[model samples]
Target: MKTNRSMIRTALAACGFGVVAMTGAHAADTISVVTFGGAYEAAAKKAWFEPFTAKTGDQFATESYDGGLAKLQAMEQAKNPTWDLIDLETNDAINACDEGLLEKFDKKTLGNTSDFLPGSISECAVAAMVWSTVYAYDTSKLKTAPTTIGDFFDLKKYPGKRGMRKSPKVAMEWALIADGVAPQDVYKTLATPAGVDRAFRKLDTIKPNIVWWEAGAQAPQLLADGAVVMTQAYNGRIDDAVHKDKKPFKVVWDAQVYDYEWWGVPAGAKHGDAARKFIVASTTPQAYADLSKYIAYAPPRKDAIPQIDKARLNDLPTAPANFKRPLQIDAAFWADNADAINKRFQNWLAQ
Candidate 1:
């Protein structure tokens, strides 16, 4: 009987594979990873986690959390960190890094930082994928197609409940875009108090008819169940729903808020070396390309672009036509403004 470790060693021998030696013997056996835990985690498990575990003979465990630095902060403060690696959104990554809750990587450990897309190789994180928030409509239900961000707010023209995330992040940006702010000017306009007020004013128009969703999965379900005629969704989610389930959903790329998801190590992670090794193994060009097989989020490595399925190209935010009007989410702006606007958003919702 061959054990999994024996099998892996045998396979490595057969392939002449040179595994990176892990440090920190106390934490070598296993490392815990934290992520949002849904389809994204499913894709990661298949594309990276399983392979990394098999190759390194290291145990991999996963935990799920809605993203926030508070948990990471608590763990760091208590000297009881649970997660070795965290899959973080750009804003959270910036906030966490700024607070020194995340560990900066040795650029060598993750391979060539230059190979990653601009702004993706940050001080404490490396991007996992390029993703976008775009609104989708079930094609069968729409009498006339909505082409632009503005159409998402035009109730008289496309009458029905609209689904949006309960948070102000993407919704506020969309509101400004709908109110005739140019894509380039979105964050600049949003930096002003008047701009914030204007965005909320725009949202006020759709508030009564809005069905607010709290999770990524809820967006597609909202459209499928007829709870929303249109919903703000992670572009990949809508693409999967349309492709996998044969749903007639169509994504509106106009004013889409595109950003990167990053992989980072918590400041006091026990399995530091293993976590770094896992990240390096998982971000190789092949791994990046393979990720597209399980999810629509495009890889951050430019070289991995051509390796993905050609049929799925148009659905990706990187595709030339789809990117025509995308607003690359300004992480710095969100880091600075999130708390303030969030307070205002809650108060407005109460009103």
Candidate 2:
């Protein structure tokens, strides 16, 4: 049998099929991925990674992270990146690409650019889904439902502790919106010194009553435990709590800040080829549509919208009703201003 295999290899070599034969002889590669954990990770495993593994015979090693560029920068500085692909929020993705921490991706690899939502594809990343950061309250606790962004800050009327993420991004924007900044003027207003001061001042109103949460899972848990009457959270997390756990949470779409979650390849990935292939496979119109079955995040691809289950449409941030008065996150503004803004945010938190 050994002699027959050798003869077969030689014959294949002469016929120009040697590379194909040798490629088939190797075991599949394992792609290492890092993502924001909790329901998002579980949804990706079922909708993206698992199916990709089955199709390509490649395995995946997964890890979770809270969003930031610090870890990716550390890996690059050490000349050692263990992650093949990373799930990045828009601002982080922009920063990573600018710092050369992520591999440059060809937009052509994902097919027609027009099929996706505008600004979804970047030089180093491809958007996976559209998600929103919105405040949710327990329906059982609040008899009169809060209807506006201003209501989130009206503690006198809806007296209770508020749940907010520890970061400055969404919180700052929400502050301005609740202070009466129009949805389109959020970034413009935040760009000024007085605007920044105004936002922090509005935040001061609830500073003592704010329960800071750092993780996506914690937001829903905060509401469930009655630790907060209303909390700022990723829309999908609240959706999962409601549908999966039967929690009585109601998401307020007013002034909801929406952003894209992207798939980015680390600059020094060991399985770069496989990682790119997985991105292509996982972002197909059908694949994007299928993800909605697992989580409420809307697909970034315009074509995928039609494929989504009609029943799940209203739960997505892109739904017509929910999208009204929505504030699309200004990724470019955040990319340029994160460092300075974060410093101020940290100092304010300490005080």
Candidate 3:
């Protein structure tokens, strides 16, 4: 389903920040926020939530989850959503908005639509950061570094167990790219029956050697513990490992699949007004830029780029040298086909 950008802009303009004024009495209510916890949640607390609390005297109750629509769907069906704001992946944001599980946001609250990245704004969500799925290996373990997506699958030359997430999304896309499908043509090819089979066939080559991980924190740990020579992981997780934990991991940016992480309010949020204000405060250009101080992800606002430290720019997914062969995740394609693809993935895993 297409996002109605024009409708969002028009509705937001008419409403303005009047909603903030109307909800002033509820300003100090504690907002419950959820995210994929770990280094990301820590970074957000310093850059977004704490600052908002200090400025507004509002507070936050935080929780973490491995992302999906099931919990949100259950909450909406029960008419008692506990989360005020959520950190959503692009595909989840699209599906949740379409299903009316999220509250419609007013873009006018953010000011200047053109300052944000394209596809950053949706009817029910606002883009929070730009992150990527990348592969990394322990630099000390490998005598020679692997530079491309294809290298991740070459067992003869770089022999070791492989680490992969226990999901099909990025794994399928990476398989197609390694099999020589051009980055731009991945979704187009994956849309066909033969293309899906081709991806699985490629995956079958290394299936026996795969050590599957289900969480963001596990990917880097797999590499650190020498469980796998290389693993597919979130770029920030690898960066955190190398910088924070002093692990010897090196990220391979080739054929990286980049996408946005969004802020979405659940439809029946207990602190909806407070949540809306927090979104606006935390997404200001300065706040967005400040997040990179604690994590490697890039902010979604174009204006935020200038405020970021120049030294940190090279590590971001949007940086020129790192982004050369990037493939943007196809949220619409996943929104349309995730169920069918996931079912096939599960069966493939069992067999």
Candidate 4:
């Protein structure tokens, strides 16, 4: 409705409500949320955050994923936790949920959860955003080309350079997927010794030729520099890089692994109930769609899809074609085995 982007969030009076100007005697709760960077973060601040603060007079503070996790751990360990809510990816959310560090969040606080995908919503968590990792390559470098994770291992066939996230989640899953374990069975196969070994053995095939990307932002840079011909990158990063950097690239969503994010309320948080309320307020259908414009990922709310047009909306991680060869993460497995698998994955990387 507002054409001027900068004035999009200005507080209003009377017939229209303004950000942080709502009336009533509600307590001014300090709501803290942890999230990742890029468009998703931008969207949250615009659609949900600024308005929530305006409407409820609540203060919202958001921190990044890694920084937030460490801060959360530190806060609880000190017995004077600071954060009200945290947004975490699948494994980290599972870790906190399993460790009893989170409190049960009822519907009133987070609003209706019925519109979300069944597995995306949880007892202590709610889906914040959704996205995936896919095989992306600069067209200029591909001689034979790649269509899937399995192709990443065939250096001898496609044989240029490769880039992949050094993190355990993508590394482990890609290793198994490339090794011929179908997308559905990646988590199941990861729990066994043979399965673990299988992923590594497959990863070893590319270690010599691989560039390790430490940040989600690094993938686009690596591609732009021609550091690696093919990489497993978050879909948004590749999309932005192609659009902004003018690099020639394509996302082969086939054999893609869908990743999810969740918002968790910290147990013993002083203002946790209010924290839940803010999350729901910020994650509405319009907000989720707005977030995707900045982040290029899908939102957790299933209804958000219709907000975008048929052409643009089809770019999402959960789009039918993308989901056809989707890889579902095993949050329980990651929660149970993170410590061990992390160590093993690190050690193998050293070799």
- Pull out the clashing pairs in model 3: none
TM-score head-to-head 1 vs 3, winner: 3
Clashes of 3: 0
Score each candidate by Cα lDDT: 0.87, 0.92, 0.91, 0.75
Worst 10 residues of 3 by lDDT: 17-26
Ranking by lDDT: 2, 3, 1, 4
Per-residue CA lDDT of model 1 for 1-351, tens digit only, reads: 559878876776677564343222223468899987767788899999888777667787988776778889999899898889999999999999999999988777765667688887888988899899999999899989999999999999999999998899988899998999898998899999899989999999999999988878889999999999999998888877877788999999888899999999999899877888888888888899988888888888988977888887777888888989889889899898889988989999899
Error at 322, model 4, angstroms:
2.0
Query: Which residue runs does candidate 3 get wrong by more than 4 Å?
Result: 1-27
Which residue pairs does candidate 2 place in steric collision?
A: none
Off by over 4 Å in 4: 1-30, 54-60, 67-71, 244-246, 270-274
State the lDDT at 283 in candidate 4.
72
Q: Which parts of model 1 have CA positions greater than 4 angstroms off?
A: 1-28
* Displacement of the residue 135 alpha carbon in candidate 2, Å: 0.8
Q: What order do candidates take by TM-score, descending?
A: 2, 3, 1, 4
**Candidate closer to the true structure by lDDT (higher is better), 1 or 2:** 2
Cα deviation in Å at residue 129, candidate 1? Answer: 0.6
